[model samples]
Target: MIRILFTMIAIGALTSAQAQTIESGSHSTTGYIKSDGTIENSSHSTVGYIKNDGTIENRSHSTIGYIKSNGTIENSSHSTVGYVKSDGTVENSSHSTIGYIKNDGTVENSSHSTIGYARGVKKEWAAVVYFFFKF
Candidate 1:
């Protein structure tokens, strides 16, 4: 009986850990743009932040890049990496069409690959929200 209980507990723990990993990897949620320019997930977790100067920072508060007023996303070295167009489309710095934010908040990569999605608002609203909060 003791061995059985131990085995079950171990299994449960393993399963829980795996679930957390999966959740953290491709988690989708409605993020909010705080008054201070910090972005928080649906669960109120601080994923990153955007500074007034357009610097993007991760949860650890490390500067990653910047988002230009024109919607261009640049690296820390100020090189343009990607951009979000006014039409809700995302593209690489090379100007090649990458992907688009659909009417349902789905985000796809250049290959039409689903990186993740947004929740809570209409397509346009979601796009606008993401445009400011994107990291």
Candidate 2:
């Protein structure tokens, strides 16, 4: 199963000149931004978000890495990018999702899911399943 690496909360807002506002643990409409108001780096445990003019990226788990808008979530060692939705869902990149995922170390930034697999999943989606075939 995937896990959280790091999470940092800064109780301040960065100016629009060099950065934007990032209210730690604020479940409001606006999320947090980096010092540049564009680029976001991992503080630890949660997600590092970038201001894309819409949809404030809440948090991701990664260590000593950077974030880009071209749909890329990078990590070093056991770091990962976590996902959170409006309906209260948390997804990580390390989870195999179903049974097709392994520790190949190539997970994408998907919502409430692991980047390894997306096959034979339930339509309703109750919980994360890990199936092992018996030979």
Query: Which segments of candidate 2 are over 4 A away from where they belong?
Result: 1-18, 25-63, 77-90, 95-135
Clashes of 1: 0
Model 1 segments beyond 4 Å from truth? 1-36, 40-44, 111-114, 120-135
Ten-residue region with minimum lDDT total, candidate 1: 16-25
**Candidate 1 residue-wise lDDT, 37-69, digit = tens:** 666666767777667777778889988777778
Candidate 2 has its poorest 10 consecutive residues by lDDT at: 126-135
lDDT of 2 by residue, 12-107 (tens): 322333332222122221222334323232232224433332222334422233232332233333244432222323344553332122222112
lDDT of 1 at 129: 39
How far off is residue 122 in model 2, in Å?
A: 31
lDDT of each: 0.60, 0.27
> What's the TM for model 2?
0.24
